[model samples]
Target: MDSHRIIREAEGEVWVSCKIPGKPTIRGSLTSKGISSDEVPEVTASEEFVVQEVTKNRITVSCPEENISCTFLSPYASFSHIHEKNVSYLDISSGGDLGVSSSTDQTFKVWETHNTEVKSVLEGHTRDVFSCKFFPSGQEVLSGGLDSLVKVWSVNDGSCLATMKGHRGSILDIAVVADGQNVISSGQDGTARLWDSAQGACIAVVDDSYSPINAIAVAEVGNAVNLGSPKETPSNREVGTEGKLVVLAREDKSLEGVSLHSRQSVFDFDGSDAFNCCTFISSVGVLAGGLDGNIIHVDIRNPKSAVETVSWSETPVLSLVPFRDTYVASYGNGTCYIPLKGSEQVLQLTGPNRQPVFQVAAWKKLVYTCCRDGFIRKYEIPDLG
Candidate 1:
């Protein structure tokens, strides 16, 4: 008879031990940098068991004699009671210390990321707040809601600094431009608008897609791409508006890129299904998640077709966020995955229990996810070796 045990020796290393009655114990270890021997034997002479793979989220092991293979999911820290109803969205501050979350309960909260303690309640929205983000300065927040209004709030005191109203329908997503001087928002009104954050004025209607814009991402485009100059003199208040592109995920199953300065369409790629979220992975790369769970990666330089499309499930992808060399994606099936770039390995964040994960945010190596189950989960990814 034989016995075996597996243990996590440290953040990125796993140790396994196997023993047979009246025989010396066999030990081995696996690490992100591959097998190691300083802490434990790289592999025992018996080779009864082996550590097959190691990742930030889980480890896999196999034993031939036992004819068994098993996977162990890493543990995570969770902040419960963050919301009363479904948590619609969450964003971590640039400083990585604070976070803001909006819920279907018609409430938004600024909280301490260390412990998820409520810092302040932002209470101006008359309807469900659908989207929220921390400004680059991390001292304020911008939010859009079902009330068809965009509000900026002071993080220090939770005061509504300004309310910008223009959309005839609910605001679905929001993006803050450089330095927080200006912001952009998309809505059910089928329009994307750029607003002067301080004055609560709409600088321009960036795009009128004639279909609901479900999500948007703003980033500086490559220098070679021509962003036509503004027809009229640009507003002096529009900081970081030039050379930037806004990617719109439309309900009409199209992903379009519009130049911020000229409000001209850069490219429009037809998608297989309605896109629910989008994000910029690089200066020239964009990723959009569709309702059918397809994650389409497109090169803005040549947006005639997608560079790659991957789908893990038929469930709708609710959120897409670039993290390190990879991106984290959340689905309506309560699953979240971190697909490592240039690798076949994918890390899954466990705990949602089939409850739809509405959003995923990353800061440094920490990943935060909000779910319909009213819990905010924080995953501290071990430093990759």
Candidate 2:
């Protein structure tokens, strides 16, 4: 791992699909935020997952009004269901097969969800597997965790192909672009690193606001601050265009920016407490909240890149997201949806307090979080008001 990969916070969510007595439940986990080690929970017995399973490559997810869907599993691919238990994390390829990360025996598990069969087991990562995502092509998959190494595995045989060592502590968050040529990661090291997905090389590094990165976002980390690797010729140009990642830095008091292509510090923002997770909405030239009580925005064009403005909050801010080309933030009280374009006012989600929001996964269109009282929630975002 690189010496600079240290961070201070990973205040995001850990997601698992499980079944309660009869209803569906998602054990929301908190990780993937800033550039520092995660803080000790107010209590030590905070759940590690949404549910604890007896078997390694197996999770327990509850379907609404059903006895849990005992379905099929496939090759190195993602499941059709947004959430599944015993499955660490799920990734779907264009082909519809599912790739899953599991900590059962400390291996990445692949399956056919339709039949619920195991395909292959990838071995590595000393601790529980945090997440597993497949390449856009589905030929390979990436897994990360507490042991602090990102392992790339071959989908064909479930073999450990290569490893990218950069973080100094546990790796809590990992995200792959739609193209799969690049990847972004945040951990206890308070910094984020961009890597070449194909060669497994370090491209650029982003300096987080002295906190562990629980979640990360990388698109063109701030206007060519540095191109982490050489420009992608042929299909490689796509590596720098069209795709972007919005990281929810798990910092308690601040946020920063980095160039995934060059791996350099792009900018920073002041925070009151560590942030948890975030996402990029290129449509607005803005990045939103997850940590502090304020929803901060960054100006991607300037050299001294920092937060431009912040929407004040009354509770702990957990996640930031760009929905329908607008901006949204989830907090301890509820969710607030904001429009970035005009003189629009922010919309708040009225609810109870201590809604432990782990992160906002844009792809699922479901704002997933955990309640302080111990119930997981998946807030579905509707396209229409």
Candidate maximizing TM-score:
1
Ten residues in sequence with the least summed lDDT for candidate 2: 1-10
Over 4 Å off in model 1, which ranges?
1-57, 61-75
lDDT of 2: 0.50
Q: What would the per-residue lDDT of candidate 1 be over residues 1-385, giving only the tens digit for each residue? A: 1112223344354455443334455565544433454453232223556667654455556655644444444436776687888888999999999999999887799999877789999999999999999999999999999999999999999999999999999999999999989999999999999999999999899999689999999999858477787788888878888889999999999999999988888899999999999999999899999999899999998999999998755689999999988888888887787755554445666677678989999999899999898888888765432
Which ranges of candidate 2 are over 4 A from the true structure? 1-123, 154-158, 194-211, 221-252, 262-265, 302-316, 327-357, 364-381
Give candidate 2's TM-score.
Answer: 0.54
Looking at model 1, the pairs that clash are none
Q: What's model 1's lDDT at 57?
A: 50
What TM-score, computed on C-alpha atoms, does each candidate reach?
Answer: 0.83, 0.54
lDDT of 2 by residue, 1-385 (tens): 0001111133343332333333334443323343223332211112423221211112222233333321111112222232333323344444555435363345457755345466777776778777676776777887788888887888778888778888888887787765767676778887666677667776656455466676666554433343344244324533653323244466555555544433344455655555655566662255546444655566655524444545434456665656666665656554433333443222333222333433333333433332232323333444423
Report the Cα lDDT for residue 60, model 2. 25
